[model samples]
Target chain A: MSTYDPNVAPKVSNKPIIWSLFAAGGTVTALLTPVLVLLFALAVPLGILPAEMFSYARMESLLASPLIRLVVFGILFLSLWHTAHRMRITVHDFGLRSDGAAVFVFYGLAAIATIVLAVALI
Target chain B: MSTKTSILPVVGSHHRTLEVEVLRYDPDKDDKPYYQTYQVPCEEEWVILDVINYIKDNLDRTLSYRWSCHMAVCGSCGMMVNGEPTLTCASFVRDMPAKIRVEPLENFPVARDLIVDMDSFVEKLSSVKPYIIAADERTVEDGTFTQLPAQLADYMSYTHCINCLLCYAACPQVNLNEGFVGPAALALAHRYNLDSRDKGRSVREDVVASNAGIWECSFVGACSEVCPKHVDPAAAIQQIKIAATGDYFINFLMPWKKSKNTDEASSGGGK
Candidate 1:
């Protein structure tokens, strides 16, 4: 019996919506992550950068600018989404087949974090 | 047959006897497949296919496998040569370790020994509608479909998929997701979709743009790596993903401004 049916469709997936975010997030993470790591983790910790360069008031001052806030928001937003997607794939790679749960949990956290970040920015 | 003219780069100088462990299964008899080792006196120029051929001809008459056209063209001789999915014809025996292990291509049901059941593969292939879809059928009198060299180049590499299933064997997505439309089929779909003469891209999008189609592919790029013909199926899938994303936004934003070139294709396409 012929089992192949191209016309047969299951529930239409909204994966593209999420995948677009994932891809954009990946690009942002790849580009900005290393520089951010060097500045935050290496230079700041090593005292190569003056501690005040990354101190709370300096960060607040940077965030006070609308443009700076948006750029920082964009970075955090994309990076969070990217990390969530990577977590999903990593979970699957580790032989956990429960994609539904992973998506719900990881993307759920990402959504919450993004909302929190957005509200904090405002 | 010594010193035969060949297009393959000459590799391995001297001959040696190799221990080849070929996976064997007889569905009518055995419950599970098992390795049956053979001491193959492999020639320096011989590939893994030749080793298997020697085993079939001399060592074990019961050995079953599929292969034709020993020069990588037929694409039927794909197997796990030392745990790596490869075209046995292109992989020299000299390149394999002394203790070689050969098995059916991974992520497939074994029909026999090295011949995996291709029923699902065939079904998926048919689902994609591999041939060019021209709304206006061209007769012999109308002459051949003329394509620009650029248009040809757009999809020429993908046309090289002989359905060897090596990409499938290598792809983790294919193994994890059974519903995935897979690399080779999606690449072939892209081939037709890119063809200037083919107007069926909109129609094909029903299957190509589905979640199981391009979205299921995480762009592991293993498909591109294992491809004998240098077909970058991963890139093709990524290209489709970008198009599908655009389609998603376009459909939501300005639903009226829909055209095949600059705009809409259904994201409902799937496996």
Candidate 2:
């Protein structure tokens, strides 16, 4: 007798959705994180680019464009989601018994941060 | 055989004494595992398994382990060497320090000294149906099946799995989820799925798509690093995930067009 029944469908996994998000987040983070760090930590502090580039008035002017706001929001949201997903996996790798509570805690922070980012952008 | 002509203790051969710590346990005699040390005189070019053989042959008759085909072909020599999954036969004594620690492969129940129970691994392997399941059966009238070089290349690397269980020891997902079909089994399934002769991908979807299957893997890539044969099981698992994702959408968008187990040949066009 066959153990699997096609009709019953051994409970299809919803992992594809989460995995796609995680993958997209990873791609975005890997591409942009180092450049962002260099710009803020080294380039700005070293005065390689004028400090006025990141001045409050200049940043506000940049944020005025919906296109720039959307790009920045996408990077922040994806990076946070990537970190949350990676942290969950890392905790499990450390041999800690992860429960539903752990998932809630990790992803809840990302969700809250995303909502806050959205409000600020608006 | 003349003792003088034998390879054993050839004159003027260099030997260095190594202190080897081996993990030991007897189910009936001890409640917990313990390490036992033996000073072994090792040849300059001997591998770890050779050192273990020296211990068994000269130092202690009671020491237990499994090994065959002193080369890396047989996966039976897999054990923890210096807290890393390795085939003892591939670890040269010259590359190691004076002291060596050997233990059973981690995340598996130790059956005895250096040997872990493999029943669960065998079950997982079988669950994936590691053999080729052709859509149509060929009779005696049909001669030998031929395949293109490209088709052979499609799955040649995955065929190198010697069932060493090193990947299982290295995999964090395998350590966490008992039901997760470990790296080797999943890679083997992928290997068969890639084969032009096989037709059991739909049948295998049940286990590979389940929560206990590919979903459990978090893409740690540890399995590929520890594999002696460079099977790259992590890559195979990811490929399975991509295929499974495609299957999910295909099933959702066009349920009527979903191919049945027997109708697999009609769908596989490239073969």
lDDT of 2 at A6: 26
Q: Chain B TM-score of all predictions, in order?
A: 0.88, 0.91
In model 1, which regions exceed 4 Å deviation? Answer: A1-7, A10-12, A41-55, B1-14, B135-144, B257-271
lDDT tens digits, residues B1-271, model 1?
Answer: 5686976755654488999888999999999999888898877788889889989899899989899999989999999887789999999876778999999999999999999987777777777788877756789999877766766776688799899999999999878876787898888988877766766665666677766677777778999999999889999889878876776676668767544433223212211
Q: Whole-model Cα lDDT per candidate?
A: 0.81, 0.83
Model 2 misplaced regions, further than 4 Å = A1-10, A51-70, A116-122, B1-12, B135-146, B257-269
The most accurate candidate by TM-score is 1
- Per-prediction DockQ comes to 0.32, 0.25
User: Lowest-lDDT window of 10 residues in candidate 2 chain A?
Assistant: A1-10
True contacts kept of 2: 0.29
Fnat of the models, one by one? Answer: 0.25, 0.29
Backbone clash tally for model 2?
Answer: 0
Clash pairs, candidate 1, are B206-B269, B210-B269
